[model samples]
Structure formats: structure tokens, C-alpha cells
Target: MDYLQYAFFRNAVIGILIISVAAAMIGTYIITRRMVSITGGITHACFGGLGLGYYLGISPVFMAAVFAVTSSMGVEWIASRYRIREDSAIAVIWSLGMALGILFVFLTPGYVPELNGFLFGNILTIGTSDLWAFAAYTVVLVTFFALFRRTIIACAFDSDFAQVSGLPVRFINYAMTVLVAVCIVLTIRLVGIMLLLSMVTVPVLIAETWSRRFISIMLAAIVISIVSSLGGLLVATIIDVPCSAIIVLLQVALYFVARIGKDISLKRPIR
Candidate 1:
């Protein structure tokens, strides 16, 4: 409890809250749009970005963003040009990107212990630069989401209708990819590439059970994310546990509780 008053804990809470909100908002569309698998492909591709950073001895964040955006664009290009199933395309990107990433890292000079952070994250070690970049990305994501709110709803509800109404479905889809890429880059350093999907999906799962409206669900997800972040950090500080695991565990617990409640409600008799 005492550590809650500390500046580092406070910043961790804020950063994670922003993460939850951003991921949940994008995740809603991701799940509804059946893009979860594609998102997974991009997550793996982000390893290329991490490898690029290591090879150039530069900031991983910047390198990750570049690789993510490029990979996302490549996916978009392929999906548009061929009449192939997205799953196959995603599979191709997933395997090749990861293989290339590993190759690049193997070729890079020197032994860098921090490389593991890309795979498993180093949440406790987040410094000022990470926090600032997170805040900037959060603002940008929120702004984009807000501006395209109606169109996104339309696309989610009925892509045919959205397209008929003159909304650029392909462009919006591309935008969504870019958004996910940005989040992937921002969060890989905090939650790692391996555990990133949990952070993105768990909060949204809880919110979907409890919320009636899209806005409410997104807001609820943000709150859940914040609570988990704080709880995880507090536990880590007090008992020296892994913060990322603690945070994810907390989300899993909340998800089960919400699922159980839903099941119970469905079984109850209504007047």
C-alpha cells in the first residue's frame, strides 16, 4: 500500500491504464472483425522490429514501430492483390517474419541481455522514455478511434453497407492494421511479444460480459486494465514477483469471474 504512493508505481498504473484502453478499443473491432489471427501474425512480425533494433544498436521501440507498420502494409498489399484466404497469408507472414527476426538477431553483434525483454517483457524496468512514448501513442490512438467511430461501427455491423455508403472499407482495414501495429510496438517492451495477446484480449473479454454498449465495454476494459496493472505492480514491489505475469494472472482471474457470472445469469429464471 505504501508503494502506491511512490512515483514509479503511479507511472506504471497510468501507463498500463492507457494500454488497456487502447488495446480494448482496437480489440473490440479485432474480435468482431475476425482479425485476431491477423493480429497474432503482426505480433510475431514485430520480432523483426526487435531484431532490427538489436542489429542497428538502436532503440527497440522505434525499430519495432517501423517493422510493424511495414509488415502490416505488406499484409494489406497481399490481401488486396490475391483472392487467397487471409489465414494462409497471415501464416506466411508469421513464420517468415519470426524466422527473419531470429536470423537478424543471431547475426547482430554483441550479447544483449535486453533482447529477452522483447519476448517476455521487462515491465518493472520501464523508464521515463517508455512512459512518454506510451502517452503519445495513446493520444494518437484515441484520436483516430474517435474520428472514425461511426465508420468503424458501420464496418463492424455490415461491411457491405459501409462500403455502399462510400466508406473505404479497405482503407479503414489498413488503418486498423496500423493501429494494432502501433500498439504492438508500444506494448512489446512492457508485456513482451509472447504475452501481448493476453493483455489485448483479456480486458475486452471481461468488458463484453459486463457492458451493453461499445463505449461502456471499452471504458470497463480500461478500468480493469488499470486495476490489474496497479495490483500487479503492488504485489511485485512487496513480494518481488514478476510484474507481467502478475498482471496477466489478475486479468485471467477477472475473466473467469465475469464468465461465471454470465453463466449464472443465463441459468437463473427470469420473471
Candidate 2:
């Protein structure tokens, strides 16, 4: 409670709430579309942006957004345009992003800034600008979801059928991909590049074990994310532990709880 007095802690709380909503939405979509692997690819791709930004002495978050979006789109582009496999494209871009990141980092001049914070987590140091970026992205994501709920569902569930039905599947895919990339970049501030995938996914995975519907999963995921995230923050302050690890651990702990409940319910007598 006392930690709330600090502006950075307050900013972290707000960022967690805002980003959790977008994360739930995007994570649900990713899970539905079976594109979870791309989350890792995009996360790594943002490292390229971070390295580039550090090398150029610019804002790492901004460069991360650029790299995240470009690499994500690049994966889709090469796969669609050149008939390359999607996994193959992801692997190539993943490697390229890492390679570029390392190269740029190594080339940075005069005592390079420590990137471990960006690598592991930055919630404790998140600023007003980062909060604004997350808020803006959340607004855009909610609007997109609201306007095209059915279309998004159709595309997520059956892209081939959606394409056959003239539902603008390609547009939806690319649009969502870009949205996802930006979301990933914004989220890096919360849990950093290494652990962000779990922040989005572990909640959705827990929610999935509880509900089958997309909306249910999304709502449940949001709740799980908010709880685990905020709870992690507060608990970390009390125990002086890392917020990212606490958040991830809480989410994983909830998954096991959900699994236990599910197993127990299955053992009950039929109604």
C-alpha cells in the first residue's frame, strides 16, 4: 500500500491494468489462431529495435515498436508472398533480430548502457510516456475488437472459410499482427522481452482451462492478468523480489489451481 505513493509504482500499476486488457484480447486471438510461437519471434524482434535504439541513442521503446511491427509483418510477408513456410520465416526473422541486436549492442560506444533491465523487466522504471503509449494502443485495440468482433472470430476460427466468404481475412490478419507487435513492444516495459510471452499467455492458458468461449476466455484472462500482475507488484514490494518473476509465477500457480479444480469437478457425480 505504501508503495502506491511512489509515482513509478503508480505508473506500473496503471500500465499493468491498461496492458492487461489489450494483452487478454490479443492473447485470446493468438491462442485461437494457433500463432503463439510468433509471440516469441516478435519479442525477440523487439530486441533488435532496442539494440538499434541504444546504438543510435534514441528511445528504445520507439525503436522496439518499429522492429516489432516490421519483423512481424516481414514474417507474414515472406510467408505469403514468397510461399515460404510461416515457421521458417519466424525462425529466420527470430535469428536475424537476435543477431542484429547483439551486433548493435556490441558496437555501442563508450560504456554501453546495461540492457539487463530491458531484458528482464522495466516496470519499476516505467514512465508517463510509456503509460500513454499503452493507453493509446489499448483504445485502438478495443475499438478494433468492438467494430469487427464477428469478423475477427471468423478469421481466427476459420481463416480459409473467412477468406472464401470474403471477410477480408488478409486485412484482419495483418492488422492484428501489427496490433500484436505494438502490444508486445508496449508490454516489454512490464515484464521485459524475456518474460512477456508468459504475461500474456499464462493468463489465457489458465482462462482456457476454465472456459471454452473466446469472450469468456478473454474476460477471464483479463481478470487473471490484472490479479497476477498487480498482486505480483505489491508482493514484490513487500518481499523485495523482482516483479516479473512474481507475476509469471503467480500466473503459473493459478494454472495449476485451475487444473486441480477442473480435475476435481470432473470426478464429481453427474447432475
Q: Which candidate should be chosen as best, given TM-score against the real structure?
A: 2
TM-score of each: 0.93, 0.97
lDDT of each: 0.81, 0.91
Clashes of 1: 0
Model 2 over residues 235-256: C-alpha lDDT tens digits? Answer: 8889999999999999999999
Worst 10-residue lDDT window for candidate 1 reads 1-10
Residue-pair clashes per candidate, as listed?
0, 0
| Candidate 2 regions with alpha-carbon error over 4 angstroms | none
Error of 1 at 38 (Å): 1.7
Candidate closest to the true structure, highest lDDT = 2
lDDT per residue (tens digit) for residues 125-212 in model 1:
6677778888888888889878988888778768788999999888888888898889888888678888888888888888889776
Q: How big is the RMSD of model 2? A: 1.1
